[model samples]
Target chain A: MPCQILPPYLLEKIAACERPEMAHAATAARRSLVHDAPLRRLGDRSLATDQPSPVPRIADPAMPVESGPAPTVDRTVSDAEGSENLPGKIVRTEGGPVTADSAVTEAYDGLGDTWRLYWEAYGRNSVDGRGLPLDATVHYGQDYDNAFWNGRRMVFGDGDGQLFNRFTISPSVVGHELTHGVTQYTANLVYQGQSGALNESVSDVFGALVEQFARGQRANEASWLIGEGLFTAQVHGVALRSMKAPGTAYDDPVLGKDPQPADMAGFVTTDSDAGGVHLNSGIPNHAFYLAASTLGGYAWEAAGQIWYDTLTGGLAATSDFAAFAQATARAAEARFGGSSAEHAAVLGAWKTVGVLPG
Target chain B: MKVYVSRVGGVAGIRLTWQVRVDDQPDADSWWRLLEDLPWQSAPSGPVQPDRFCYEIKAEPHEAVIAENELDGPWRELVDRVQRADTDSR
Candidate 1:
């Protein structure tokens, strides 16, 4: 056997740091990359989940591809039945008739809509840019109040009736979860510090685009709010977070104020939530909103396309906000011309957010 | 005795916390038992999945950042009880 300097677990601890520039951490990440399927996942994954996660579905080339006029959207929905188990029982699949349970129908349609947004706008087939089947589980745990993409698939919770409703109620939330999977297959930005925030912002950007596309709304016409209908009437909030104006999404005695910062001046620094990935994401969220709204038409046409290109083109696992800003600027210039308003708008948005110089 | 739980992460990325004053409860011993059952010597450490809920639990130096799926038995009971307490997460 090859000499083992440190235990595999110790190597994992170093790999979890995921800072590619750090020689020790990078070597550890590279070593851990082949330790096991699950450990390799953490090499570029957003979450350092304790439990073993389900393996991502790889497209089987051995299985023949079905060519047709329209690409098939394969979605599978499951019912957890108030348990924490994922994909508990398959309740619905592609082309299945709507179920009596609203959660089931909503999840199915939401998954389809998210898949359609990626396909229709970017010509991306699915989360992996391959025909990876989409899977989602609903009614997970009793009165569970959050939704998530657990590396392999989406899991939805029925919100506590006191403060929130079913998670499937919002299209943006669904879009957001699915985009995490997209990020996993693309840039796979390390889910810590500024890079984690960029990973989050990328999801929010496409999440908003998915909602806007579904509604056929112009960039300026869109709500620009994520989780718009997730809150109960009792909660004093319009949405979970806002792209147009961050920190102003909600204010209530129960949930407190929205903690997002719209610009670098207000950027929050912390160790929680993977270095405040969700909190600092507001900075880029607002930037995309500004660029899309300034363009005055469908966001997917220019602003969204630029962001999409930047994401798919990939970045270092440790790309910070400034690096992401420069990449988007280059993408905009390449697609829309260096002198075009699209390029100018992208640069101006980043400058306004303090990610780039004015 | 205060048992604190703050759930962060998920797609929403908001932090919601619950601080239970176990001393205030008549069944303080029961609460203590649950708190003691948790792994306090070292926080459960590992890589978390994207968009999964991460909980920060603290009863003073006894703190851990646990992913939602890892929560079981006492951890689950404490969180569920704290949540059902219906106190606002300030």
Candidate 2:
């Protein structure tokens, strides 16, 4: 387990404190990683087959009891019925409303749209490519500052609302969360070390692609940034992370600089949270950016197809960057041919990211 | 009070039952408000019978609080408010 995927230097940074309590917490968290690592290995082995989930059904009060094919639940139920009479989406919208509506509504809408797109675009339904209903929740904590797909439904925090506004509003943010579900369904990639980084990168690639496709933007025209519109104007530039240029996304003093490394040499290899999945995703993020740019058209059409095919076609749980590169190459060849331009583009992109064989 | 949640044809649904010690309970209205306030789109029609109601809440995309005791803050306030209304009518 190496006590976490973070470098000892970064772990030291997190442990920066003379206070005994703070130091003890960090030490304990690091120690806990030893146990978690082996369990993760077990998970990798278990993930080789389709994971079983408790299937959920819609329980609409208005509908009569009838059993046939389940009706596709209309997502815009709250909107369709008048707000005065109908039930509000998640939290109440009108009188005595305890939860904020905008964040929850945005998250809900984004999940629905992303689910629909995944279904409509590639004839794949829902997160699992089955007709699984997409699930999400917003306003998770008082000032929670991150959003994640926690092996199940999507959960979004309201954010500090200072550095980051509501996370649900960004299409890329929702896309990122949904991609985690997709990754869970298909690749079932183990979350640690280089493999974990690739997992994060895959989410970023799909995240940006969802945004690009939503906006009808070509790859060249795309900004290639993840969470581009998430930050308030006071912070600095556009986004929390950038796929096109890895570390250059944000350098503000408050949130700290984006620590993603663009090449294999700079790859982070600590063991916290599945080997710093968020940190090392930079390498794969940059690789996808290169692939999309090289393809020189809508990313969803070519690069997205290659990646999606690779993911759905029985991917190993512990596949690392090199393995992923080979898979993408194989997928591209299977999709476009061994000597095709798309295959060449895939190779070139992996090479650029230093994932390809020397 | 015993609440029953059953799954019928894969559709998980909620059924509510409450026992009252007092006849013609004055706090029933408050209970209705609480039931209506639950974060579910599929609830039964208004309040039902003397002290029973049925509703359904799907468990996905969001989770909701299903039960609360009268001693709890909001729930206590509701019972108090209802009791005061009954006293005034008498």
* Tens-place lDDT digits, model 2, residues A145-259: 5566655666666655666676676888788777878877777787657766777778788888778766657798998888876777778767867888888887776556767
Cα displacement (angstroms), candidate 2, residue A192, comes to 0.8
Per DockQ, the best of the predicted structures is 1
Instruction: State the displacement of the C-alpha of residue A215, model 2, in Å, after optimal TM-score superposition.
Output: 0.7
Clashing pairs in 1: A47-B48, A47-B49, A48-B47, A48-B48, A49-B47, A49-B48
Winner by TM-score: 1
Query: For each predicted model, how many residue pairs clash, with residues at least 3 apart or on different chains?
Result: 6, 11
Q: Please provide, for model 1 over A1-358, each residue's C-alpha lDDT reduced to its tens digit, 9 standing for 90 to 100.
A: 1234666667667655545355445333333333232333345344656734433323222222454555679999999999988779999988888889999988998998898778756667888877789999999988888888888888999998978899999999999999999888888989899989988888888888889877767787999999999999999999989999999999998788999999999999888999999999999999999999888776866788788878877567799999999988887765555666988999999999888988
Q: Candidate 2 clash total?
A: 11
Query: All models: lDDT?
Result: 0.80, 0.59
Q: lDDT winner among the candidates?
A: 1
